[model samples]
Target: MLRPIRALAAAAAALALVCACNSASGGSLPGKPGDAAATRGVSAGSIKVGGIVSMTSASGYSKKDTDLGARARYLRANAEGGINGRTIDYIGAEDDGQDPGKNLAAARKLVQQDKVFAVAPMSSVTFSGADFLEQEKVPTFGWGTLPSFCGPQYIYGFNGCLVPSPGGTLNQTWPEGIGQVLGGAKGKSVAIIANDSDAGKFGIRTFRQGFAGAGFEVAYAKASVPATAVPSDWSAYVKDILASDGGEAPDAVVSVMQTPNNIGLFTALKRAGYRGLLSDPTDYDPALLAKDTTRQALDGVHVLLQFEPFESANPRMDQFKADIKAASGGREVPLNMHMLTGYMSADLFVSIALKAGKDLTVAHFQNAARSFSDTGTLVGDRAEPKGQKESFGCGALVRLKDGAYEVSVPFKCYEPVPFK
Candidate 1:
């Protein structure tokens, strides 16, 4: 659900740009090998930055708060004295509307017109701007759910890359955490479903191996659901799923899809009288609780969380809540994963910028990122180059009971299984 697309056409079209894009060649920013003074967005007193978020979308799935999240984090950083005495001049994020063309256009506008030093919290399923950002040597930070976050020197995931190439390690968090909830993964069976898109296919491949490695029988794994539209009738999917485990339903049903899809699928499964563990990565939002149908549909469902849950006592979580409240004009607001998405994305950028030292250039940022590592933060110990290849191997699971969310599993780092 971290990277949801409307259809295969969108992903295929966006990925098509990868071939035409240039790849970074070294630790320093490309183009001007040694000239830090000529960096695009760095001024003597400020470092200008921007973001690209799916603030609006055709399907009505908006991550609009992501912009506010980035703003809050940046505002906090500036208030705390900014990086190396240069306050971050955040011009805010552009709305991609979850379209490939618009995503690319927004990236171009940010770099070419606004000349942002970096693009943090670039949240959207259609990231056609990845190639352009890398080619331009822009240091971008975002959720590493997509393949673009992996193997890219100029791009980073706030929590490290979720999808990595062969020989790279896989995050065992999802499987291991789920295992903990079900007593153990020893003989549990799971049926995983996703959209029939590039990201969906990749998710199935990565997660299938992860679950199997965790000792679960992947009873049914497929990226067959149509991505363009949510099916009003999920009977076909439910029918196959109920019998996926040798004529009986699996012990758990995992949906690697967004809110709309999860709601439909989970509702169908429940109506079909299949009482089993239902899990997904995207339904942790507090906003969904307002609607009775959504609340009932997702009741008893466990959602994946790459970061510490809000219910956590982690001091960093408290700081995030405070920052979020301040960003929302001192008004308490409903929290969602999208807000964390932007906050953490900006946090990583700020962390690396601080390590970049007082010089504050693209080259300095890249140099700092090459050896960056921090511990006990929200996402666990973050290490780069390594993060560029694998996840931090940390996470937790939260379940919706009645109308509130409770941490089903404690936040902790787990040993990652090697991805074959």
Candidate 2:
């Protein structure tokens, strides 16, 4: 009885499809290869693309301008006759709010409903949709700070993977640049702090090895800070960090967190009379200088950057500035690293898609990706598949002083140290 009922249902569905096809004057069915090709986000004149970004979050961190950066790159590409004469139909971006569930939902909406051919500028603290995007064979590009970017065939990081598992090499820019700032790693002590999240824990693990490998004494490393809420009181954290060197403050304190958390902690440290060197990966934005308190708190602080700073004299950097200004309607907005993140992500996608030739398809894109290599890019020399497991090993350090930024360490590539 069950088998008969199932067969009847299947027959009914087939009949409905045939009737629909007949209604369309004997047109082909939707699941055919020709239909699939036509239905994809590509056409003879354009390629549809979209983006996912953590534009807003509970902690007040926003990557909203990443959309603008991507738009700037896309606009430039389109102005220059597009990729193989097909203008990119960039659909802007989806705000994920940094929520994992929302991230997945946004990705699904883009693929299932929007039918975008690819995703670029996927700037988010969480990438819960990585697995779904991979299974669906959707090409994704973003800043590769999470483990999800590693070993995924369909996902790419614009600057290569920042986080890698054992047997992979770690970018030594952070530790090595810090070592250079302090004159030497020998006889120096450091404390590393991060939020109590997967990213944070992994950051602690990676940097612990990096600093130790650079000959710095890893006096303290902890990921006990809150991931979502910014703690108002930093006394307890300060106490632990101050005594991390067995009774005295470490020579340097490093934070692997965003600006809000950094401001609170660094302000607290100053209040607690910690005069040692301070550093973090974020907080290089010039807009922070608008407030006196923010400037004072970050005064003399060194920041780790994985690309050439906005102050670079490189011709490409000048072009980036011009493109951004044009994208913003001639309004000069204060630049941040997030902009570069988006620009580079889109730039990488465009570069590969162009190489895939005029008749673009997912298959062609992946084939091109396998051999993608470019030097003198804004981030660094890029190559595919290898980037899934390793970094491009390029970065620099900048220091803030009296409301200005100057390169403490020049932008350059360094050999990576193996992750133990």
State how far residue 70 of model 2 sits from its true place (Å).
0.7
Cα lDDT tens digits for candidate 1, 1-420: 012121224455446544244433322333465555567888778888999998876556788888888999999999999988999999999998877778878988888888788999899876778777877788999888877888878999999989887888899888998898899999899999998866688789899999999999999999998766788899999999999999999999999988888999999999999999999998999999999999999999999999999899867999999999999999999988999999999999999999999877777788999999999888999999789899998999999999999999888898988877
Q: Write the per-residue lDDT of candidate 2 for residues 1-420, one digit (tens) a residue.
A: 001111112322232233221111111124444432553677778988999998898999888889999999999999999999999999999999987678877877787778888889798877767656776667899998877777778899999988886788889999899899889999999999998765687788889999999899999999899988999899999999999998999999999998889999999999999999999999989989999999999998999999999989989999999999999999999999989989999999999999988767777788899999999988889999889888999999999987999999989898999987
* Pairs of colliding residues, candidate 1: none
Backbone clash total, candidate 2: 0
Deviation (Å) of 169 in candidate 2: 0.8
Over 4 Å off in model 1, which ranges? 1-14, 18-35
lDDT of 1: 0.86
lDDT of 2 at 366: 83
